[model samples]
Target: MDFFTAQEQARRQTGRLVVLLVLAVLALIAVTTLVVAVVLYMAGIGGAHSQPQPTLQGMMALLSWELLASVAVGVVALVGLGGLFKRRQLRRGGKAVAEALGGREINLNTRDSDERRILNVVEEMAIASGTPVPSVYVLEEEGINAFAAGYQPGDAVIGMTRGAIRQLSRDELQGVVAHEFSHILHGDMRLNIRLVSLLHGILLIGLAGGMLLRSLRFRRMGGNKRDNSAALVMGLGAALMLIGYAGTFFGNLMKSAVSRQREYLADAAAVQYTRNPQGIGGALVKIGANAKGSALAAPQTAEFSHLLFSQGIKQGFSRFMATHPPLKTRIQRVMPGWDGQFVALKPAPGVTVEPDQSPQSTAGAGGRASVRDNVRASLENAGAPHAGSMATVLSAASVQMAIGAMGQPDQRHVAQAQTVLSALPAALKTAAHEPYTARALIYAMLLSENDAQRQHQLAVLENIALPDVFTELHTLMADVARLDVQLRLPLIELTLPALTSLTIEQAQHFRLCMERLIHSDGHVSLFEWTLYQLLLSHLSEHHGGAENLTLQACERECQRLLSVLAAAGLEQGLESVQERASEMAHALHAAQQVLPFELAAVEDADDMQALSLAVERLRRLKPLQKSLLLQSMARCIEHDGRIRPAEAELFRAIADMLGCPVPPLLGGGTEEQAVLAE
Candidate 1:
């Protein structure tokens, strides 16, 4: 689907919501008006001595109008509140996406060129597609699945499950990635996130109404039991609230319908992005045949299923509430002849499996015929010097992974992160700080993993060399917390790694810690849990068997944690951690604190100051800090309703002071983003 189509769909959905709310308001007003009319009509009893009073009738008419007007205002207010809350959610989600993806540069420490190649491919595609390269994440899941998430192209992220890397062929993986990219490029992601926020807001109304009704019922039952008039009012309030809830149900159905339609478009867009339906189509066929398929047992799956490559979640019991179209319809769309009957596709006879040497996709870039040449020779090249690089970024995932291209990342993503960090450009390799780059990297890395696996990975690292890698490991965790509006689950998991060294019993203790934490937390973060579980699988080499009761124990522990957090007093917050972390004053921490910031001589940095005055102004710490802020500032020029171009410049200067090199902006990707065309 194109941008225009997405807009039309959003507009229609939004309009439908408004219309329904309006009707609800009208119904409420009419009901109230009728009830009042009947009451007033009875009050003016017809008796032998009864006299007509025009003034009484006129007063009642005026009261009825006032009541209708008030209800109209209330309904509009509800809708406005939804939009306001939704807008805030969109802002926060967008920021999290940017922080997770934007600051990542290629980490030079990657064991093999596989990740470097992944970075290069992402870069090439971004250049070709005329957009900035998106952030890439590797999932630790052994199952093949990928997803794209973010509100817009500037902030979009592409994450793949570990299973995808282990199982899917290069072309097949590319197909999955391309489908997600299409969702990002075509604006499906923004709509999906909006749906989540808006639904939460709208649902609050029904919840409030229910609470109000319950309160009235309790109030009337107290000492006012025999007050017939109050009882009548209480009953009327309950009926009004019940009527309000009916509207909420309709609104929910509409929102779900909107979500389902976008899923279809994303599927279509994925095919368009890859230009190879069979790559994704074939993968789907395999998933359908596999018993596990795309089903994720992780509790977080339900929260983000709409953003997945396939249906990994469900919302409510009804079919309309489902986020994605049925599997049969999806398969038929991609592969027209695919029968619902599962027919296992057989590899051709006598096919010899060989090392992958040739490029499967990359749209000819780094190949015999690249996307750059294919498009540059056409009339589409608009003199953008960096176009080639960006295109590689987009087409990167579509490339087939050769045996040489695949040096599998450790299932423990924290360990893999240490490896990823080592591969970074020298100037960008900053040690982990709470609000800095490590947090971002962890988000990108974990975006690729599910919750249970994430927990397991953290646990494994804790048992392995966790205390040794505090800066990177812990900061990575902070990033997860920052992105989530909730507490850092990994922090709770981080409590168990022995500072001295691992003992046989220490490892067992770590396993128990995971079990206790999970049982306490109740439901684990689906993505985080997936990562931890994967780590457990990888740790099978060091530990005992892969599955026994470790995961089960963790699940039990999570329930306990959730109940504890609910109780509130037992939970620790950041202040305690900050005080504890004071002892972690290593070389990196010292360097961050003591280094004298370096500044470049700006020819015209200050217009208000004379040359001497300008020099004085440049020496100020605020100016330098502001300059440092610019380097990491997102593409968003306006944040929190304030313009910050000057601040952006300052951020750039400060980052340079800290010796962090900034990347050149890659603008306007062709073929995908029309915004880039401008």
Candidate 2:
């Protein structure tokens, strides 16, 4: 299934989960009400003059509507309150989840080779997939396990056990990381968080029963008067415990049904992402061969068993309760020809691993020939351009491929990402890994092309930024100016982990400095606006909940986005105003053809502030609705014969806002590159 279909399926699964939760709650209420009725009847509290009979009819008579209603209300309130409390506690997103699991966030500047290798793998995947690079956490455990957790990509984190990093090879580590990325892309993280919250409520019933039983230990039953009351309390507590545990038993069954299939899907996705079945298959084999296996040492493993890469806890007495498929089964699915033998893992001695270099050719020469034919076909379908417009044909194909690769980047994208990362300067890469210089690197990117405006922004930064950071900005300014325009976003992505390391006060100050620098020249270029929005979306304190917007609800926002994109596509060097207007009209017409309704041109079509507002509103579009809107935007960009750097950047920014990860359109030098080179 494609990313959108997977996301829709996840939503359906969540609905099913809610239904199961309701059934379980109803069962708990019924059981609790019966227990309460029995307690009252035995204690002779049903009525003062009532003659208690030892019969089923007497029990039925005692279960009055008033009594049943009161018990049901109490049970519902307890479960509801417990769920709300857990959700509130986890409001900080995946970081909170990680911290609760005894994970320590890995520093971006860590010197440990194992930590560095995992960090590199994660960065490559993030760039290839066009999502924000997630925060990495390390659990000091010897088990080969990992998990991805968060409500959305913006606040997501990837956690790994020490053994997983130390024992797995680079390819194996990449496989595991890709498996987690699938969870993020397929909307599994949000569903997993919801499971954690809802299950906590069901577990609360058992906890309440246990607490009641323990409290009865200190009470003294002096005479027969107190003996009846003691016996009644003991019976009620025992019944509550039985019912609560029964509810828990059903909840685990529900979790197992929901989680097992997704594990298989994630394994397949990992192989698809790396085009290396052996990578993931080998990891599974090692897990089986190792004595510890993938079992976690953490006490909270049972709570997050479904989130782990492998089963982190043992299934007691029943395969039906296992959240993951058996190890051999998972291995065979990834590698169908597996001999069903587990490979024993040994510690690597004096081994140093480096990031894989980009291949000289991607896939093979046949792939390039196929791409050419596809581009030619696209040009013909869109009405042939002039003979010298090969660049236009190539750009068209890139945009189409980008749309196709959303949330499912293949090996080609990974190689392209490696090439980009390799092209970055060593010094700048180092700066991107440290918080102090990372801020300066971002500020340097925002400096204006005009010498006076650049100096003005520098002046603003010098006053508000840390003295050391301002100095670092001056030192990096020359290199930043010379950097390729296409590399700008990837560079910003690299800084995310380091930036996240800053204290709250420090982050706030950094954001303030960025705003001053962007508006220092009285204008926000498209690049500046895109950079600002990307940073703001990822770094913000609050992560927005799931959205269910339809196309009709976001009609105005859709038009605004298309209008801005259509205007962005017009070549600035067009010989005449009429030529520019003609291009804009063509772009708009192309958009209208894809859209269900007519799109009217707005007067301030290129207004950054207005575009920002439109983007915020459109971010709430449903996954399928977003797919349609993106196709319209792509149509507008392709209407023009050629794709400019500015236009590609704007398109990427919009896609990022809509939660679609489009790989970088890597090719050809731009005018900005030429100017920077000079």
Name the top lDDT candidate.
2
Best by TM-score: 2
Each prediction's RMSD over C-alphas, in Å, is 19.7, 6.3
What tens digits encode model 1's per-residue C-alpha lDDT throughout 1-678? Answer: 323344345545545655665675566556545544443343442221223643555435535566667655665566568657655645634334323322232232344334434433343233223232355666544444666666544445566654554455555655666566556545566666665555554555555556656776555355643344544445545554665566556655665576677767766755654455766777787667656567655554554556667766544577786767777788899879766775554321221221111233432123422543344333223321221111112121111111001111111111111112222222222222112233233333343235775576565445543353434555455434333211122121111111112344644554454444444434544333433443232222221111112212233222222221112211134366444233222211222222233222223322211322322222222322322222212211221222222222222222222212122122223452322111
TM-score of each: 0.44, 0.90
Native-vs-model 1 lDDT? Answer: 0.41
Q: What's the lDDT of the predicted structure labeled candidate 2? A: 0.79
- Residue-pair clashes per candidate, as listed? 108, 0
Error of 1 at 288 (Å): 3.2
Worst 10 residues of 2 by lDDT: 384-393
